[model samples]
Target: MRALQSDGAAVVHRDERAEGFVLLSPQFKQRWRFVTAHMGNLHAVLDLAKVADTLLFVLDPLDGWDSTGDYYLSCLFAQGLPSYALAVLGVPDLPQKKQADAKKKLGKAIEKRFPDAKLFPLNTEQESLLLLRHLAAQKQRHLAFRDRRAYLLAHNAEFVPSRDSDLVGNLKVSGYVRGWTLNVNSLVHIVGHGDFQMSQVDAPPDPFTLNPRVAKGQQKKGQDMEIQVSICPHSQQSASVLMQPRKQQPLQSEVIPDPMEGEQTWPTEEELKDAEGSLKKRRKVLKVPKGTSNYQAAWIVDDGEDGSEEEEEDDNMEDEDLMEEASQVVESSEEEELAEEECETMTIAESARDDLYDEKVDEDEEQMLEKYRQERLDQMFPDEVDTPRNLPARVRFQKYRGLKSFRTSPWDPKENLPRDYARIFQFQDFSRTRKHVFRQLEKEETEGAMVGWYVTLHICSVPISVMESFRQGMPMVLFSLLPHEQKMSVLNFVVRRHLGNSDTVKAKEELIFHCGFRRFRASPLYSQHSSADKHKLEHFLRPDAALVATVYAPIAFPPASVLLFKQRSNGMHDLIATGSLLSVDPDRIIIKRLVLSGHPFKIFSKTAVVRYMFFNREDVLWFKPVELRTKWGRRGHITEPLGTHGHMKCHFDGQLKSQDTVLLNLYKRVFPKWTYDPHVPEPVPWARNEQQLFMQELEME
Candidate 1:
């Protein structure tokens, strides 16, 4: 009902004795941030829940628990906090028998949701002290699960031009390290940027503290810290280099000869004249008479009888035979030369033909061909458009239906029923069960409230670089099959791949598939609903359905080398989903891909005012540490205390002006730390992890 403003600090509310009586124990002092129910802002509640060590759910005996109260309770449960306490008010004045019965009924309701919560009476001072004691004891255990200790390795770095003439010799850098343990002495390796000797690490003091005190020891490990490092830029490259694909080189045999070789050759004038004379002389063609017969006559040789004559004739014959052998060898050499020339000509022809076939069609020719095809179709069906055959005869042309607004209709209890109405349980009270299950949501809503909500799921076994991005607060969304419509189809595809070509039937009906933080278990049992239940579930399968089943599967950190990170110039890491294995089981298939789509904008500095693109004052709180990058690749961070009208002050390595364009990157990197691994084999239903230990204990009771 009251609000107070504090200068240079967050507003704090203090209750006076007249307004509300307070009881303080000497042993411990408690600080509370009161959040009212009528505010209707769930984000504020969630933010407060993150900082609260323990949660208290207050219930009035007379009012009992209504839809609004259930909604708040569900928000608290969604946080998955370690400690919870329930306080039932207005029970002290009731009769002993009635009080006992009320306590038993309330206990049953609370146990169903928070099995491990401690119960107490609101009017009892002793019980309040006990709740505080329990919360203090569990604080350390919860902190261990929430805190992640990791270091940030620099992904990109650049030198900032010095503004002051005195600091000309020194080089300044406005880059960030994505991990913790960064100090003045920390030697950071920047890819594509040399490892400079850091002279000073200038970091802004914590802004939350009203009167900040200088820390004597090393700085604490937390979210990404923007620090300006003054260093002497190294002239030589660093040992660490960004990974890149290797360039392919041509092989020796595949290399082509130089074109200049053929051009450099020249024939002498004497050789050219001889070649011309041979062409002029041409072939010695033997001319035949007009009346000569076409067929050639065969000649036969006769044998000689005289012995002396025979010896002389044999010598002449040997000389003639040797001359004939020499002529044959010359002719074979000429034929080989001709064959080589023919092969060269054929190769040239083939290359020319290939070039002609591969040529692209002219734009004019393409248009002409399309026109011809359309004309031919038009001639075949002259009135096709007027006499459409696909549409129903009753369908009205140019008339629009309100199908787009169908989901906005008011809730009708009778019209909307559960999926399995035909197979209703004999003893089950459907209305009571619905109220109990959907206590956190509005009464009119029938589907799950948290179905489409996006949360960053930690992945284990990711590459060291990707892990650095995670540590820096990059949100990696866990896309589960429960939120998707085509989950059954994808499951079938995976099963078929796993079975290969074998026609053997799978013995088991149920199969579990895990990707990132999502764990999906599908079986025939899930589909075993009554006819009415099937109808209800089928409604959810529609494209416009608002409700979905609540998925409570365990999630864990992704493994190394499983995800890829690409650091953009605006200081946002774009997740490369390609080559990412979505599921290790079912033959390690890669199905869906995701990218971190951060909001981007341009800003500039004017006379004592910072100008930004399309952001209101309310949006400033959501996007902290708004990253700024200049056109020249210089980086900077916007300091707290944003100005009015989408304007905010920024800190950069160098000087800037109104005309200079600065890009802004805004994204949520901090995510809830999950404590359980969903991929562990043969996990007991109740004995999953320490978080579930209390639930298991309660289930046994």
Candidate 2:
């Protein structure tokens, strides 16, 4: 109240002393001005446009019940009034932890909408008077910035329009001035009773600037006529005037008047003290009144003390006697009321017990309902050992469900399924059934290229997880894209099962072989024989078979026959003579050496001999000379191919082969240690002799 008066403003609050009239400060009383009736209304927010230069709304978060800080702040924004929030007093105590979060959320919400608006968190010790003083100083500087600015006064109190007021024309502003990003820096100053007039003005300078006022040294931007702030300064003296400390002021006090009415009221200290004393006594007398209605206490206060001070003395004696009668009557009535209340409560308890009994009876009814439900289920689904296909769809689907349930169920198995039903649904090739599928997938020992394709297979009821696991186990074969025929063919070879009605195991479909294509040919045969070729006939007829074959082993085959030699980079030549019969055993390669070309010898070992070169497959007679070129003299090492080259020359720096005849001393040679499995197939017949020779040369150790 003091701060508003200092700012030449007025405030109002409801009062009973003045009846319809409001009270205000001494300064307003001297001018005969009071705050408006609208301002005095507690429910109404003060129309700040008719009050002071800047509006400050001090929001008490705790004042309202269960207030969401966000909601309260948003209401201020919705009003569309350019008002500021004084938040320094701190948040109100909320029922839950959400209040703290709500406070921060509300701050962010305000920042989004009113980015430039100032928010001050006033310290708890500070009051509105201190804040208002600071704002008044700020407004003084704001007015100094604009030249030719007019001041408006309503009922002797300074008034400023809200930011939304259109009358405040856009002022040419530079940078963030006056401690704010000035949106509209000047207003069309219109004041007085009958007619309003406007005058142009320049906006204020930044409040943080050193030279805020338009003084002598500074040149004026336009016509130099500074708008002075009409402020009513605080009149009370400082601490020097007070002899001792005074009581702290309460925040909320009744505003006596709204200045819009031009009336003022300021009460003397003595008069306020008398009112407080009388009110205290009245409350004490009414504290424990005798009454069941609660109406008798009010009648006592009004009737007993209604008259003036002189009439009150005359009734003082009557007051004590009246009080005794009132207490006795009230006590007697309370005892009677208590007895009636107890009876009513007993009736309610009995009603509740009856209700509980009825609820138990209802529970019995539900059990009967459930019993009927079970009977219906049993009748609809009678147990049958064998269900016919000609039965209803429901029965058929149910029977199928039952059969499938038993297949994977944890129950005891019934006897074998009916013979007729099994025969009808039975697999022709039971190799594709679940039992055989799992069995076939586990088998490993197989021959040939270890390759087979299924020709016809259709999968229906298989666990997805099982199928996925099976696919992962087979690394080399990606059977996802293979034809069904190929999968069935492979499964048939691997998996086997007995037929439903027979004992025979199933087999895969046969494969077709193509031999030759021919036109008209000669009838009789003409024969010519060379002596060298005749001797080579033994190799082509019953040649040797070798067990162990080294990876990437090469054979040498001449035009007459095939010969195997273990050729080494170190020029240590060894041979298993041609026409030697070599065979694979369980632990080693068995060789039968025949004296066809080289020395006849037998090699029973774990390692294989490289015996033959190209004959039936491709080129038969071509010999390229070995080229020798190197400074290291490391004997034999093949060079990488040159550009556009066809064949790499075997550059034997040592004089050995231009298809030269070389003999292997089979008795003196060394071989690497490697075991051979005889179950694996042998090389082609003609190449067998060559391989035997090579093994003899490189004898297995």
Q: Quick one: best TM-score, which candidate?
A: 1
lDDT of each residue in 1-701, candidate 2, tens digit only: 23233333233333232222122223222221222222222112212222223445544544321223332233223222333335444554455786677667656655665676554544432444455444534532122112111222211111233356533322211111111111111111111100111121122221121212334654455432232222222213221211111321122111233335444478899999999999878664444333323432332222232223532342233433433553465478669978975664212245444644533242464575565455444445322122122443232322221111111333222222222222112234433453453354346331111111101111112223323322332111011110111110100000111111111111111111000000001111001122121111111111222212211111111111112222233332222222111111111111111110111011112111111211111111111111122222312211212111111212223433223321210010111121211111111111113433432333222
TM-score of each: 0.24, 0.16
Q: Candidate 1 — which residues are off by over 4 angstroms?
A: 1-26, 29-39, 62-64, 71-79, 93-97, 139-145, 149-701
Q: State model 2's lDDT.
A: 0.25
lDDT of each: 0.32, 0.25
**Largest lDDT belongs to which candidate?**
1
Give per-residue CA lDDT, model 1, range 102-129, as digits (tens): 8787877777776876676646545555
Error (Å) of candidate 2 at residue 627 is: 99
Instruction: Let me know the TM-score candidate 1 reaches against the reference structure.
Output: 0.24
